[model samples]
Target: MKEIIQINLDNEMDLILAHKRCMKIAEMCGMPSSFQTRFSTAVSEVARCAIAKGKNSLLVLGINIIKSTQKEIVAIITDSEDLKSCNPEAFNYAAKISGHIQYNYFDNQFTTTISQQVLSPGLLTETKIKGFIDYFKYEPPLSPYDEIRKKNIELIALSEKLTESENKYKQLANTIPILICVINERNNVLLVNESLENYLEKPLLTFERKTLTHFIHSADIDNVLEGLKRAKQNRSDYIGETRIKKGTNYIWHLVSITPNKAEDGTFNSWLVYFVDINAQKMIVETLKDNTELKMIQLELESANSQLRFKNKELQQFAYIASHDLQEPLRKIMIMLSRAGADLTEDQKKKFYFDRITLAAGRLSNLITDVLNYSRIENSEQYFEEVDLNKVIEEVLGDLSLIIEEKSAVIKVDQLPKVSGLDIQFRQLFYNLINNALKFNSGNPAVTIGYGDIPNDPNFTGSAEKYDVISVEDNGIGMDSSYSGRIFDMFQRLHERDQYGGNGIGLALCRRIIENHNGLINFSSKPGVGTTFWIYLPKNKRS
Candidate 1:
């Protein structure tokens, strides 16, 4: 069904327009004069009944396809009011005239449809229907009375809206607790609410000759005026805290000023509100005068900071230990069970024993890593002259099994010695190399080398010339957008089931680098690879 025209049956004038529109549409559909009169009469009768018995009655005329080929002119009348018990005489009359009428009631609303078969369905083509729509939209009324009636309806609607707006403004100004003042664009006060008059202890008429800044304290008057000036120039709202004069004393109040724009996009006036903040001000003053209270607050803040740091360290330790230990423990249990079953085969028993040893070794390494992570978190470890080359070697040895399983390649250049915690550096490379091996789709090729630091604007390190080491990989890379938050705790780009281990590897690397007064960053592209750049300060410190 395609609706061409709709009319709100608000008054007798609308009913006449509905009937005329129905008849004209019927004629346009190639109906004979007799059928057009009958269809129009039936639609008008139903519309009249709906208007009399219902609220917000609407009539729509459209073309509906029947049985895929036949076309008929349909008129639907809907209203918000329930008509279950209303008289059905009009519906019956419409059905007799049009031969098809449907009345439906749902959700306390009713709709009545009246359809008339087109005389020549082929004549009512798409072009013809569009022509009908354009005619009803742009064509002049058949009589002068209709044009006058439409103008009158528009005037009535505008008047009602203006009345409603005035009533709302009055209700809000008189009832709200906050003080309100209306000022013109010239900053001259035009109106003051009763609350404002009471706060000033003066009559409302006295404000007519005063400026908007009259009630503000001298110390805050300039700021309030500047804010209002900017707001007026930009046609935006202004909010600031200022001291307002109440009786004989000045009290702090949050002032908000909003510009009122007219229909032509010009500012006419401004509405200013003052809300009391005296209680909040008193509390702030009391706090400022108490030295013991300030000391207690500082101590409490420091304690909270330490507590949060410890809690985070414990959480990471618990999660990483539990997550990494599961794999090794499962392997050890499976190897023991297999060895128990195949005690007669010496070769199989040796393989099971080797697997158990490897699992135990991995479990021990994980425990040491977790412990080192806690020490690094607490800044308990002292820095020494650390050999990066040896650290890389140890990390490679720790990840030897995964590297061999994945047929991975590791390329290394001469890494410079730096003053840092050895255990932390080992854990950093362990995580980076292990990730390179684990997240690869095929054989992983990782290159660990040092280079001159790139002049990146986003780098925030304080080093003039630092040791810049890069760990590049040929693995499944992530989106570059995740680079910002890639080092956040527990932030994983891939699902755990797809990739193993908890999402704390990169976070730990970042924490260790920060502890050494350095920065760690990465660049990645999906399907290409990722390269992590580490910037370490050259200066030595305790």
Candidate 2:
């Protein structure tokens, strides 16, 4: 070992000294110059590991001529027992000589061994083919003392470089913004940079060998475990959101973990970084919630505006139709009445009298329906406590003459006392009954039934409200298509001669229910029957 040469492995610049000596060794051995690139790379890596792991260790590099035809360069290293703890996998390191070298770890230290032999005459001749043929021939062979002197000088230079580099890296690792840490496979912290002190408010020594969960907030334990599992299962980068305990306060941190793999593709540990994204997360949540609330407010405003406009248009239409057209219609009716009286009995025959009377009767019904429609529009239909049963009895009484005229069998159920306007609600029931009776062309048995649907859809104003009334009839039922259009004003399914109506009955029913903040929907089939459902607010009295 005394004749052998040794150089400390430290820093990139100091690598040139050992590299220059390796080239000389290769030349003296008569190996082709091509081996120079490979030999230099191998030597530099071995030197680095020896110094990095060998805190108090020394690297012993030696070249010996086994034979005149073959030469070997071997590196022997001795370091603290800590080297035994280092992983045995080899790592590739780059050398300044434009080549890559592999490191093979061993007990107590690692070694990089290079072997070279003299080339044939033909290969040596080809080395001059590219450039620099004369320098190879004139160079003096290196003695053993020269190798030692050169190695010692290089070692001294590398020692100084190692000190400078260590200081520089320590400063850099301290100043970095992200919290960098190295954890063992068991999630125990092996090394943590100084940046972590800001978060934990403690020194790096306190974190050593401590489980990562110690600093993680209790609420974030499950999420952190999930992130670890994901990283291990996927063998890729993992991201996790968690709250970390800093002093007595908790702050959100986004942690990222990347697996460190050995050369054999086995899991060794993880390299992690934690970024403070608490502010960003809070901002995003606030913005999202605020945006959703604003959208709801805008929608409500738009709906209310539309409702007001519709009400105004309805009022204007009703006012104009009632007051503007009534005077002219009255004059026409009086003139027609006088003209008919002047005719004699023979002239005022049955056909002429019937036709004129029928026309006048239709005009009168139309005027009455118009007046009712106008009243529904102008009236305030907000709901209050009202007796629906009493309202039904009254409506039936008004239609008593017609019921007897048709000999109709009217069935009434015990109706509920719900909240709704007296006038509008009474009108709703009246129109529904009238429709059932008038449309009874096929069936003679009139069945008027009312009941409450449990768990009724509540009114928007009072979430506990349910519609309390319904009218189902087995009379001349309408098809599904006509059922949808039944609530439209002026929409009639039959001619005036067949059904005496201005088509405002169902429309008025719908308007009254709407004013009470209720829903009016129905289901009907062509040949089956029809059911008109009115959903009233559960707290109609509220």
Candidate 3:
């Protein structure tokens, strides 16, 4: 069997196309006009049924050899849907007209085939069947409502002319360095030179029949179209510069369009040329200014210096305010302790003295966090070689009281020595381990380990290699949505009654990591657990 044409039986257009293709193939097989009409109608009936009831339906026309001296014109319709479900009248009519019909179902697919014996089997030689295949392969499909016969004749003529012209210019176009294009008067590209194809990083088939605006940048399209329109009106040449796309980038090109005329001096087509000008354009842009750039740099430096001075002043003010507030808070705590000694339990409940003490303690913690956050900026000068194992040991000892209360299990892996402030590292681990025990329901489990650093683009540090340490716990985790602002100052995700903190721990942690030229991040789930990953540079910055 030699398949001649295939059409997707999707809509009315495909049904009409299937009918025309069947008739054309039958006529090509030396069948009379009466037989062609009957065969085509038979195929259309099955095709219409397939389009109505089937999924991904297809119609194929082929020539099947029945015997050495016998041949048949065959039409096959295949679909994902079972043909038995379709109206049986379509198949009966096809069988009545074509005299032979078969329906088969296999591998979850349905196929309905119809065949009719050709009038002259010997006329359809092997060479003639091959010619039929080649013709259908290159012939573009036409709509049923279009002037099908007229358009077919026109296309054949145009194909001959294009062949002749391509042969004449193929060598010259490929040999030239400049990009060239030949377009009809209607702006449809007839041919594009090899240079244009190579420059655009695409094939000639992609550019053929497409207008110049297809390859031009969106911002420069209007100007290029206007130039073409004006050239068409004046019947003259056009020269302009625009950006043409090359792969993913658009490069500036100087375009020249010259009108091509016949012997009667009537314009028929256009000869277009493109010269690259991106490098020249960049040079011109770079040489346009220098004094303004220097002035802008100086202004930026001055502004940055003033910003540094203001930040220092703010830090000092915060330190002084927190120091002064602590003294009064300490006095309030002492007075509350002395008064609690004299008051009965019932009297203390009535006066709310215990709540007052708790509030004062929370305020003290807030002041202390503020003081610590301010102190980190000045502590960077105290950088030294710090043993992380020792830091973890100290933090664990400090948190042992709560760990014992919660029955927390602590797992510690071997840690590396890194260049950072020892006190900050100690505080970092203390807060992390304390929170691990504090936030759990009961019987907390905490694991501390170090591993190879991951390649994270968001790590804003100049480290060749990093020591990545992780502190994970089996405690209540936070929502991932709050991850972005978790390190922001005073960002509290839970109410104070639910979780007690000054809402500055993560912010302080981030600041300390910045001082050590490191990064800190965490991942968490609401009921599962939270893990904090710290990336510390192996070497200290000068």
Candidate 4:
């Protein structure tokens, strides 16, 4: 007659679930074999009657007794529906019957009560008691109720195994390196692991009163809000990334979320885990910055190149003007000479007419040399495939008169074919030959020769494509002191009158060779002859 169970349920499903809960609870508590089924069934039947007939309320408050001697255990439930809805006479009758049953059992008594107010929307009142039927110890009662109770004991043992499995799962979660947390529908954290406190740098209790927003960075608030809304609304997993602001720095994290639902399939809270990914974020940002820097550098280089080109164009324009002006000056010098020559003996203007004519001729030659130098200086012309030997022969033909006049003993050798501008190459050879013929000490004995030094170790260039072209002479050799400036513009070691020409010839030769991307250099001794060497790169057809 002890108070075992009571319920006041509005829905039949709730009553059923409650009944199952009671049976499971009985199984979990290790109820004795003699009373296991009787206890669970008695509680189920009482709860069913209360919920169906009484107002809607069900409450199983607490367990009060466990008695091995009588094989009896008791729980108390407070229900108020019976007092208001049941007939007073029938209730009194049932109470009397239960009292008689308790007295026949033992000296102890148990009672579970039902009041009218318990059915109302308030707290349920509960009472529990235990009675033992231990007097007939020699032969225990063996009823169908006792057999059902034994099965309940077995079921309880199995449930203990399930609880052990649950503990194992919790242990597994604890072993993970990541932080884990469970939150409720109200956004309140329900459970947090030790790993969560590791990163938080605070105690677990500190997060108890705070919502998820309290730990998140302000800039990421909007994104977090959206993800939270989606998780709760759809009751599905949502994932995203955000940075957690440390003091002055920030730690980036990748968050994964999983949603759980309530018994009624309503929205629940998310199961969240945050993973640190700050290193990867920093690498991506660094690469982006470097790329931007390279682009800026390239743009600056392009601008510098454009400026240099413009400057070159201006210089070329000045050179062209100077070159064109020389023709008129040459003409004026010739006219001045002619007018001087026409002066009469009495005029006194012809006192030095020979000297004047010579001076005018020199001036005219200077103008012609200046114009040629300017034209070559401003030119950006390129070279093509041409035979150097042919260019040399043509230059010799042009200087045939000078060769005959000097009675020069000129000796020539075979030359190689090279990629070069025909006119420039001819000028280059012509200048060198002129210098040799002009500077002869005795009767001209100039020898122009061409030969390659097989794999010349002294030559430092791409061996596969570079070759040296030597123009050697056996004329009056120059002093070592003047050899260095031999290719300088208007730089004459000997006087202009002595050399019978301006000193721009060798300088123009240097320019023409350099324009072909070749080197022009010479070696000389005071008494020995000189040799001018041109090292050029071979052009590939491709």
Alpha-carbon deviation at 53 in model 1, angstroms: 59
Which digits, one per residue and each the tens of the lDDT, describe model 2 over residues 337-379? 6877878777767437656766766776787776887676433
What is each predicted model's overall lDDT from 0 to 1? 0.80, 0.65, 0.82, 0.62
Q: Please tell me which predicted candidate would have the highest TM-score against the true structure.
A: 3
Clashing pairs in 2: 465-538, 466-538, 467-535, 467-536
lDDT of 3 by residue, 68-150 (tens): 58999988888998765667988888889888889998888898888989878888888999999997876665644435544
Which portions of model 4 show Cα errors greater than 4 Å?
Answer: 1-320, 344-360, 374-380, 453-465, 539-542
Candidate 2 regions exceeding 4 Å error are 1-324, 342-361, 377-382, 452-464
**What value of lDDT does candidate 4 attain over all alpha carbons?**
0.62
Candidate 1 per-residue lDDT, tens place, 1-542, comes to 98898788877778889989988998888888999999999988888777778788988899996754689999988888754246578777777888888888877668888899886787678888889889887778656777876677679889999999999988889789999998886576888888888889876444114666578897677678878989987889999999988878999999999987789988889999999998998888777857887897898678668867987788787878666766667777676776567565676566666566555665665565555455565334578999999999888888888888888899999999999888778889988988888889999999998976563445554445578898989899999688777887668898755886556688889888877767788877789888888888788844
Worst 10 residues of 3 by lDDT: 453-462
Per-residue lDDT of 18 in model 4: 52
Model 1 TM-score, 2 decimals? 0.37
Candidates, ranked, TM-score: 3, 4, 2, 1
Residue 282 miss distance in model 4 (angstroms): 14
Judged by TM-score relative to the true structure, which candidate is superior, 2 or 4?
4
Best by lDDT: 3
Model 3 stretches astray by more than 4 angstroms: 1-312, 378-382, 452-464, 479-485, 525-528
Candidate 1 local lDDT, residue 73: 93
